[model samples]
Target: MFVLHIALQGCLRGGEVVFGLTADTGGHIRYLLDLVAASSQDVGVDRIVVATRLFHGAPGPDYAVPEERISDKVELVRLASASPAYRSKEAMHAEVESFARNLVAWIAAQPRPPDLIHAHYADAASVAGLVADRLGIPFVFTAHSLGRVKAAMLGPAAAGCPDLARRIAAEEAALARASLVIASSRDEAEVQYAGYAAYEPGRIRVLPPGSDLARFAAAEPRPQVDAAIDRFLHDPGKPTLLALARPVARKNLGALVRAYGESPELQARANLVLMAGTREDIDALDGDMAGTMREILVLIDCYDLYGRVAYPKTHRPEDVPAIYAHARARGGLFVNPALNEPFGLTLLEASAAGLPLVATDSGGPNDIVETCGNGLLVDPRAPEAIAAACLRILDEPGLYAACVAGGARAAAAYDWDRHAARYHTLLRALLAPEPPLATPRQLLVCDIDNTLVGCAAALGIFRRWRSRQAGLAFGVATGRSFHSAMAILEQQESPRPQVMITSVGSEIHHLDANGVTYTADAAWRARVSADWDRDGVRAALADLDGLVPQGSLEQRGHKLSYFGDAATAQAVRARLVRAGRRANVIHSHGRYLDVLPVAASKGTAVDHVRARYGLPERAVFVAGDSGNDVEMLRAQGHAIIVANYSDDLASQAGLTHSYVARASHARGIIEGVGHFRRMLADAG
Candidate 1:
């Protein structure tokens, strides 16, 4: 099967990647290249294409080339966007529309479309989604680093940045739309993604990326590599504390320097060697990198750590393993004090080089440390904690020996061949076509509480009628959670639905082939997540007078529940408008209020399901009975308002096109289905 991978940030090319050439150029490049190489060996994968932006001027001419063949099975394709100059991830947004259009044109000209498009990072996901939609294919997304998590890490000031907000929106879209989401670690899959409005835990898969550490594991110290670092240190023979990362504030390199400088014991124990990205001139660097370099220099000077510290300004990619080897030869520890790391590739490199670790507790390290048992996790914010962990490892012999043993396991625990096999299986499953009989021709959706379960006798009658209907996929759309909806359906002996849209249309789940389990719909989540600002909504309504927040159970990633009346809902809407937050406010039963993403509602979700199943608008029927159901009830499809509808739903404006059923509860849904069927027959 042919697979296409899209990664738009950084200078990506075949052979000898010059990392840290740009602030955006980092580990993700290493990850994509490694993954492609591994995938090339898989027999299931016949052809592989890596798509990146084509740009010229500065940072080398390799990026200007439109295409390059890496191997017999793997090729690189670069498409030009609006800009021909290199742009950071932050600046890539402006190029998305043009990039997508050009990419679509490029794909149309190809011999055959790729079976699947794997998008890396949010900007590339945005382009992939558009391409997939137009071509009617599937795409998977891998968020190397999520924007919402980064914004939170950056603190309150990040909330006002338009670029961050846009990036977060793109991330939400990726989560909502991708056929699958690949996460590098559990922390990324569970914690980081949980913060997004489109987060669906069932749709996310934790696939730890394999590290190519054979070189590091077999590495030996070289004279040249030693001299590159030793030139800056007064005593090069001391046990080294090594930190290798891009010269950015988020790396927290300054904090590591301060930690070493503040502790006299640490200084006495080891020399600090910092290999922050290759730089020609400190003043010529970008704003963030330049500031970070200046801070590190200042801290070293302030603590009189000149002799004990070595901050190298440059190193080639091949010099990395040797540098790690040099550190291991000196019996040193590798340190990663970044505020947050998506997946620590360097940690695996350090471990393979037989260097024990002192990494930040915030992200990938938690899983890496737990898996390999080779490191101590510390809070990056605490300099004292950072220093203490390093000191503990230095002082204890048994712990150091245990750590060294554990480091041996890193190679086995993460293998590229294993990663490739699993990835191949997932892609094949996504590309598998469904049987004709399994595909639904019609959809019948109903609201649960009042429209389908108000009367026990009617439910029994409805269940009998549903069992005889062929090619009609039955489902329920309700404001309840999945378990709550399922419990009531089972207790009342309601017909098993093929789909369940729960959390007031914020989430969608489909029955598995096993018939007992359900899988969350990742695409739907990506759809409703567009332009959603969950935090902004909360902050906007934090002090709203009339609305009282609901219990913890009622709150959801894409939904916020409250106790409020019509006036309170109106007030909430006005407040959100004033705060420039986009959300959907729904008041039901004169006592409940729910706020959701603007793109989400029972109506839009039903439409999404209908379109997905290849069912025409006229082939779908919906039944509802409350204010929250207003959106879906007024949709273009055949609508039914059960006789028992509350909140004066029958008189709601724009619902005049709906059918006022004579029957109530489940009986009303049956009657409305018959009515629409008869209407269609008459039209034919």
Candidate 2:
């Protein structure tokens, strides 16, 4: 379909995320998803599409896994059972080619394709990258885990040999085509993506996924916070400390819990609050909550001071801010002791929530804590430092107040609205306006009745005439059907008009030689249909004796032209016009009284004829000599009114420039056409 985008109609204000999902699939996709989701929240993204397999951990419709829910604006497409696994070598290549073709078709079908595609991981990157190039669109890629970086970080999974080498090569190809490359952390970019010297440095921007501070500040406070802490802490008014992390070895929650057990102030009165197990509702990848809970229980038992610690596992995301707020009210401190943490969203969450944070100095927390002034930074590997920082937050009121004030000020600056606006700006910069597909505006209308062909005389000359004159473009606008009108056009002795407006006022057609067709409105023709005489005196003629239907509109174009000598045809016209009640009947063929529209006459017909030939509007000539010819005579003011015409018509026709034709009928028509052509050539 050829469609026109008339500027002002196509622009959007957000970016969209398209991703794949499954359970044990929290590889680089998770990192990309986290950043994008956070980025989207910070920026007001309008929509997201998640391409899902049959289930979380399965690949077909028959899988038993339950439906997965994400955001309200996100749509999920179930991948068919025929979909190939990403881990398969030969399958990956084939899938990329097939998916890219389908993806392009989908994009083209959209009302507007995305401005910039940001696909995560190598497989998705290559797929989107291929389309971006073909469609002349921009693409941004974020390689969270590259082979080299993975090899260094996760070891065996990163080694490039055979299948792994091929996978890494795909990542390299996609990155080379990326308009922009984003890295979660500088380390990942340097260790994973930087090895390619050809990668443009200016195109790579390091953007950490930012968190929303407003939501954190307004978060539903933990209602049970006071109750839980009161039942645990000895000195109720003294400051307390909070702990948060996943139950994994790298998270180092065990060290923090042990320190909380030994801290002097914590042991004396302050309560130790640990996120024992999140009521996050997100099913674990392993699906072993019982086993997970038992491990945390053992850690608590080892401390033996379990009475001073509180396990709040029924925590909802909504309660996060209140938890932070309650901790702030109680002068609580946030502690993170992860070993070699890449980037911790929890730390940013705590800072945004206005809780004075305490995190290890080695990784992302190093940037967050210091940049925001929301917390005390210490090396997590040093237990003494972790223990000491915990005691100061609990015991030093002056130092604790400064941290609280800093967190609040820092939280105020990280507005999600601002983040969304910047991302929106980047997307706009990335997109180009779609190519124009509409033609320039202009109108072409032609006469169908008398000019192109009236009965066989006019239509018969059409084909031979069109083939003779090539420069004059043709358009037929007549009160004729698409079926009959086209047949008449086809039978013409000339090439067909490119545009055919048939059924008169009903439809306008654009006919191309390529078998392409388009239909629209012939604006003027439609107006004529409503106002003109449709069931005219012509229809009534059927009831009259000797009056028969003739013209294309049945007794239209040729009118009731008298067949006998000129005097009789003239006498018949006088009788018809004399009976006029509203206006006098008109006759161009002499014997015919064409009850036409007030403005309609052969002059109108001639005007339409010149339009059909696209001659200058002022250019016209006629050869009829009766009342119907009065309009044409006046229109052509200096036209020939056949000598056989009555003196009454000659006077009304303003005979100033009249020519007494020595002949009439077809011979007069031939003379009129020849004279008009001569006048046009002379002017040229």
For all predictions, the C-alpha RMSD in Å is: 13.5, 30.9
**Which lDDT tens digits does candidate 1 get at residues 1-684?**
999999999889988888888888889999998999999998878999999999999787999999999999999999999999999888899999999999899889989989899999999999999998799768899999989877987899897889999999999999999878888776777678889998876566667788887988999988998998898888899999999999998899999998998999999999999999989998877548999999999999999998889888899988989999989989999999999898899999999899999999877887789889998999999999999999999899899988888889999877787788767866776676332236888899999999999899999899899888999999899998665576457546687678899888999988766343367888998988889888889988999998999855467889999999899999999999999999998899999999999988899899999988988999999999999899998885699999999999998899998998999999999999999999999999
lDDT of each: 0.88, 0.50
Q: Kindly report which residue stretches of model 1 are placed more than 4 angstroms away from their true locations once superposed.
A: 433-684
Q: Residue 197, candidate 2: how far off, in angstroms?
A: 7.3
Writing each residue's lDDT as its tens digit, candidate 2 over 1-684 gives 111100000010112211112212222333444444554453345555543223222233333222233555443333322353322322344456566675677668767765567666566677777777788666667654454443444457545445456667777787677766665443343333556644543345444555556677665546576665566645556555777654544456667766766565556746677764444443432223344445556766876766667766555445556777666677677888866455566666776666777887645565466556777877776777888887766567777667767767655444334444444444554543222112312122344434444446544453455445424344554544343454344333333455554432234455432222223334434433444443443343334444333322223221222223345444434444453322223434434434444334445544554564456643444455455445556665436655456536666626666555555533444455456567657889
TM-score of 2: 0.47
